[model samples]
Target: MNDQGQGITVVSLLLAGLLLYGGAGWLLDSWLGTRLFTPFGLILGSALSIYVIVKKMGGVKS
Candidate 1:
């Protein structure tokens, strides 16, 4: 895909990751009666998404 397409894909990936992980974390926190999982979930999601984006875009030369 082109740069514009890639940009959209990356953003979507990031948003999906954040929502998925964040929701999981919220659930975990609710179940465990703790408040530590939300931020961790967001961070982990962001990191994973960034890693995936870098891997996917590795072939693009600018």
Candidate 2:
């Protein structure tokens, strides 16, 4: 369906944004020898993964 294609595009964009934003921050913190960014990376990755899983499971039925 047309909407399913759109969903894929949107999800891809979200994933890219999450990686560039959160991953960059995590890398910076890691370089500085701070562990705080590790948790942030995990949280960001988990939250985005959950969102995509829910979205794919017809959670958007409206």
Candidate 3:
């Protein structure tokens, strides 16, 4: 993929990770009555997204 394609892929993955994990965290917080899950979810999501981005882009050369 080109640079623009890579950028779009990374952005989409990050956004999807954030929404999916963060939403799960929000639901967990609501169910468990805790305040820490949301931030945890966001951090986890970001980390996972970065991991995915690196893994996906690792095989490609410039």
The TM-scores, one per candidate, come to 0.90, 0.49, 0.90
Model 3 TM-score (2 dp): 0.90
Kindly report which residue pairs in candidate 1 clash with one another.
none
lDDT tens per residue, model 2, 1-62: 47788678668757875686578768979799887876677677757765765576544565
> In candidate 1, which residue ranges exceed 4 Å CA deviation?
59-62
User: lDDT at 46 for candidate 2?
Assistant: 59
Over all chains combined, what TM-score does candidate 2 have? 0.49
User: lDDT (0-100) at residue 50 of candidate 3?
Assistant: 92
Alpha-carbon deviation at 2 in model 3, angstroms: 0.9
Relative to the true structure, candidate 1 reaches a TM of: 0.90
Candidate 1 weakest lDDT stretch, 10 residues: 53-62
Whole-structure CA lDDT of model 3: 0.92
lDDT per residue as tens, model 3, 17-60: 99989989999999999998999998899899999999999774
With a 3 Å backbone cut-off (N, CA, C), the pairs that clash in candidate 3 are none
Report the error of model 2 at residue 27, Å: 0.7
Q: In model 3, which regions exceed 4 Å deviation?
A: 59-62
